[model samples]
Target chain A: MMDVADLVERARRGHPRAVARLISLVEDASPELREVMAALAPHTGRARVIGLTGSPGVGKSTTTAMLVRALRGQGRRVGVLAVDPSSPFTGGALLGDRVRMQDHATDDGVFIRSMASRGHLGGLAWATPQALRVLDAAGCEVILVETVGVGQAEVDIAGLADTTLVLVAPGMGDSIQAAKAGILEIADVFVVNKADREGAQSTVRDLRNMVALATRDWKPAIVPTVAARNEGADDLVQALDKHQAWLEESGELQRRRLARVRDEIEAIALTSLRVDLRDDGRLDTLADRVLAGSLDPYTAADELLA
Target chain B: MMDVADLVERARRGHPRAVARLISLVEDASPELREVMAALAPHTGRARVIGLTGSPGVGKSTTTAMLVRALRGQGRRVGVLAVDPSSPFTGGALLGDRVRMQDHATDDGVFIRSMASRGHLGGLAWATPQALRVLDAAGCEVILVETVGVGQAEVDIAGLADTTLVLVAPGMGDSIQAAKAGILEIADVFVVNKADREGAQSTVRDLRNMVALATRDWKPAIVPTVAARNEGADDLVQALDKHQAWLEESGELQRRRLARVRDEIEAIALTSLRVDLRDDGRLDTLADRVLAGSLDPYTAADELLA
Candidate 1:
């Protein structure tokens, strides 16, 4: 096996190959992942995690590319974990999206990797935070986690992010759909992409009205942008910086980070316990009893835990 | 404080109120859940669970209502659990969706309940199977679990169902979107709703082309329907019956059931362990250590398990 310490050293120096390799270990759940995480742990908790999410066709890739460009313009290193959909149709389209981000490919300060949201259960849940830790340790000042679709996965991205931007397009019913998906509540900033289109004003108005209804300590800022044209990119970056400042000033950043790590530890612990139960044949035995109608699952679980 | 035995008995007798109460306990994660599950265990495994999922605005509600009508027409007792999105916009829309199912509301043979996918992590994961158990033991011959949205939640529903039907609409980009969300692989049957619409044939053809690409033991059946007009309801039901027969003959039913129960047991065990670790203060100490960089999360997890 390649030396994990050497990889960590190289990653800390902003070596893209080293960072990508570390994340690959995470995504593959490699045997060396535990070592890699240990080496990366002390270097983390520095990167600002910004999550970008919306339904497909809201120009998430375009917005992400624009944000990367703006962040790089500030002379700060950046990383992006674009959580791509693993469908044959879109799976093939991921290359097209990547081509858009090639503007940063030669820049050592920018690291972009796409993690496929495969069909396996908890795959993203297990891999995402670890990948984030890799980027954070590699000295990326800001790590953008962009995910497609508006459902539980989007909510999950919110939980991982320090500032979450919910993207919507004009006249796509995206505002109402975001509201219905509960994506509105989790957003720290709302980006009205394709803003030059008709109905953009109405979409923004609807979002503002909904935002007005909720009394939060920080009201999510609404910014309109035509991502394809790179309009409002500066405003979007400013909005993100403002949220970052508020997060620190209000002490919400530390709290959110602590809570995030707490969840991570709990998730890891639970997964370990589950693996032990399954590998030991205890789970199968209990499951057989439950399937035979001889015992309840709760009681069987209690027994396994005991 | 209600007697668990009495509640289970009433539920077994097809008392909708009792069934609802039991499910409420499940949803609430009540302290007496163990007793309730024990009481209901013997009566489960009889109801064939059918999960219908698709992107929003694809006529899931209408198709579900139509399916309830068709299932009821056969004189089989039915239960419908509509997992609604908990958003202000769609929260209100759920009432309208419920009104459509009111066609069978007054019928004692049909039980309908809507569960909210609230902003809680693992809320649906922990509660859904328990609710299905309640419906199953209540003498419902078939239980339909309908979920709105196409993401991880939809995949979770597929895991819980004996047969999963993925709905798509003509010209809605539902085909590509469904494929992108990876909803295609989880489906046992594909419903092309709104078949009278202009792009219906192409939608069906697209689904067939994708379906043919995968090499599975059982290929998903594609059925076109105008659910609002109640057209193709019989064919959908027949398709479901055919899949059910194949599941039994191919021995996939037992295998799927075993896997489902195994997952259920593992989830319960993990949840119970998480609660134990959290309540005992061990998790806090470990998380704090990990946060302080004194230890990595994986090592801390191992310590807690040890």
Candidate 2:
């Protein structure tokens, strides 16, 4: 077993191997995870969490790279969690260009990681929030969570962020359709990427109209960008800053962080309880009772819980 | 204060109001739920569960209506659960067209209900599978569950079903894109709706190619339908029959049913555990520990579970 104190000390001192090993423990759900969490808890809750989500082919990865530069230019240590809830093979192919992400590869101030769900029920693997905690405790000043906006997993990522950016491209028939899918509710900022493309103006106009129609207390700012050319990065960073300021000034940050904690705690508790039930023979006995018509599932579950 | 025995007896006799009341108890997660389940346990496991899913504007509701007619033509009693995990208001709007579904609305042989998640973490509410069990025990020989295929909640529906039909429509730009999103893995059959529309043939061709490319023991049949015109409903039913026969002959039906039961039991047990944490002082104490940095969330959760 890895020593929790040593790992935490090394990870706090910015040891990449220690941090990576800590994350692996979280993913494998090792029994030593509790000790690890206790050790790292003190240094967390200081990072500015920014979530970037968009439909496939919207250039989210490229934009994430650009934002990493913007944050780095501001002298902030940055961490990127590239989360793919799609199939494992597809995620592998997508992350194969990790070398292209090498702009920060040699810089210890930037940490980039790829995470794919291991066939979890909610599209997000159960360990993502814990992994985020690891980054938070590792002295990262800004953490960017990047996920594709195809499933509720991305929405869960939004719940873990202080500010969420919804990226859209000009001609992929992705943005307007995204609005129809409730993507507007979670977005704190709207990014129209590929601004050099032909239909960028029309895309921005349609998005502005959609924003006008939503009855939100905090309206999402729409910005245009060409990440491949490093265009409009400043404006995008400013929008993020505006949202961050709003989050802090309105005390929404405290509320959101508290909710994230509550969710994390509940998830862990539930997972542990499931393991107990499945392994303690309670589940098999109940299943037998249910199958034999002596008891129903609800009653059997109640009995087990009691 | 309803009597469990009375309700179960009435529901078993196929009294619609009794079945509705039982479902309401399931949704509210009432205290008497266990008693109700115990009474109904003997009567379930007899219904054929079929799940139909697709993106918005795919005419799933209309397709459901046609399927209800075809099942009635087979002299079978049917139940329909329309699950909308998007928004309750949208669910209300979609089901308000009950007049448009007049073929099943007034038929004693058909029962239709709408269920929407009330902001549950999993795209599906915790109550759905229990509600399905209630319907099964209430003499529903065939149950059709219709849900939008865009999110993980629909994927949950696929897990609860014996047969899964993925619907696609012409001009929606849906099928191939959905396959890329991992929708093809859970499908037992694919229906290309709106065959009268332009590009229908190409849509069918693309879907057939995708299905052929998939490495599955049982090949998913592709059928064309125009639900608005009530065309090809028989072909769809035949395809369902073929898949059902395959499942039974391959012994996959028993395995799937057993797995479904185990999953249902686990979900109920875990939900109860979460309720205990949230309603008791345990969650607050753990959150306080996590917030104060005295204990990390993972360890705090382990303590609470212990």
Q: Calculate DockQ per candidate and list them.
A: 0.49, 0.32
Candidate 1 lDDT over residue span B1-306, tens digit each: 578899899999999898888888877788898999998899889999999887668899899999999999999999999876453334545676788888787899999999864643446767788888899999999999987654453237778899999888899664465353365568899999999999899888888887888678888999999999999999999999999999999999999899889878877777776667777677778877887877898998788877
Clashes of each: 0, 0
Two-chain complex of model 2, DockQ on C-alpha atoms against the true structure: 0.32
What is candidate 1's CA lDDT for residue A231? 98
Clashes of 1: 0
Please report, in order, the local distance difference test score of every candidate based on alpha carbons: 0.81, 0.77
Q: What is the lDDT, from 0 to 100, of the residue A167 in candidate 2? A: 87
Identify the CAPRI category of the predicted complex in candidate 1. medium
In terms of TM-score, the best-performing candidate is: 1
In order of appearance, the predictions have TM-scores of 0.94, 0.83
Per-prediction TM-score, chain B alone:
0.92, 0.92
lDDT of 2 by residue, B221-247 (tens): 999999999999999999999999999
Which predicted model would earn the best DockQ?
A: 1
